[model samples]
Target: MLRGFTPPYTPDGRSSLVPAPPWHYAGTVLSMACPTEPAAAARFLPQGFGRATGRIIAHVCEWQATTDGWELLDPVNAQYREFILLVEAERDGAAVNFCPMIWVDQDISLIRGWLQGWPKKLGQVWMTRSYGLDHPAAAPLRAGTRMGASLAVKDRRLAEAAVTLDGGEGQSLGFLAGPTYGLVGAPSIIGEPTAGALRLVLPGITGRVAGPMASGTAELRFFDAPRDELAALRPTGPAVAAIGNVAITVTGATDMGVVAG
Candidate 1:
């Protein structure tokens, strides 16, 4: 049984042919999430992160209340605490295992090497036993419940999920990006109303995706040119709000769900 919480989702009937990736319900993943609007955060975002951050903060609140987990609390000055991003999915669908934090860059080739087949060292970043060859090594959006902690999240909300990018020529690209921000307070994974489509969502611009792609099944080809495949891609223009639906299914204590790419 899952010891934590469950994330919300709105169903979109647009289902895809691709199955969930192998890492979804397996090992650890190296995820990276950057703030898409660092400028806005500095100018308009809350003075602190954590619960004060808004909806996503609220979601964190709920997850902590219900789940049995630990957070890094400060004992000296009695300030500054850090915790992992907790998300829940269904016992079956996409509510089992969910790691909602991940942000990496192209220059950080070390992460890429770890994701492919697990290298000894890529660059400046070396892998620890916990991070090495771990299929689902998680790197959630570090949320700071304390005053000083939240101030550190200064960057783009760019994320690289655990999946490869390079493919041959058969797989098509079927994916979902966000509610614009992320899963709301209660973390609702919302999306379109059709078959072959599903999305999990958050406030401002965060969401989950499930669909097919001509690029190939994300499950089989996520390790090729992973740098290209895992880059955070959110759709804009006319279809930004209407068609981007998401659906999430949790497996267990491992992976949250698979994003169809």
Candidate 2:
């Protein structure tokens, strides 16, 4: 019998790419909310889901995660960055945010996200870090402080953003605080007539605002990459941005229902 939870399972379950969760994470996020062409955004959602609102979100964050232990001694394996693009969607009149694309820097994080239906891929994600200091380099929680982040994959840049903090917290970006759904399953590989799929809602998401949270003016851009479809969801109007620190945890997925195979 396989001893590990995932592939490359070792007898001791020590070689699995990702460990079992109830994962915990502390992170700083740069979130951008902008209007997108509803029709274009609708194309990314799975069958039975529809565009509920006109806003889309692009978020970049740097995370330190722990599963079984603090992992502070193994910092390299515990830290990673992520970039996500999500659109507002609905099914059976219940609103949910659906992620169309997401990128992560670590293989472990990537695999972990896929297990929760994030459609995460390997990419280079970078962001500005803040510190509680008066140095010119330290971006403190003050009006006019600028921060930036970018995402790239296969050597091609997909999205970039910069924000200048103004003021405010909590309700600065309320739209970002919503339930998210993902379609998880495999397609028929051997030409079978039908396969199975599930509409999974990421579960056990309990977290709170951690540090400085501020509203900001933002500039976001999307580039046309040969493979990345980010250009399709580019913002069509002014964007609202914010910077926040949050500590979050996820247990896995709860069965929302089944969708077309």
In order, what is each prediction's RMSD in angstroms? Answer: 21.3, 2.4
Error of 1 at 216 (Å): 46
What are the per-residue Cα lDDT tens digits for candidate 2 across 1-261?
668878897778888888898888888888888888888888887776665477788889899999877576799989999998888876567666888789999999988887887889999999999888988999986788898899999999998888888866634442347787776665576767555565655555775546667887778889998888999998888678878788878887776777652
Model 1's alpha-carbon lDDT is 0.20
Worst 10 residues of 2 by lDDT: 167-176
Best by lDDT, which number? 2
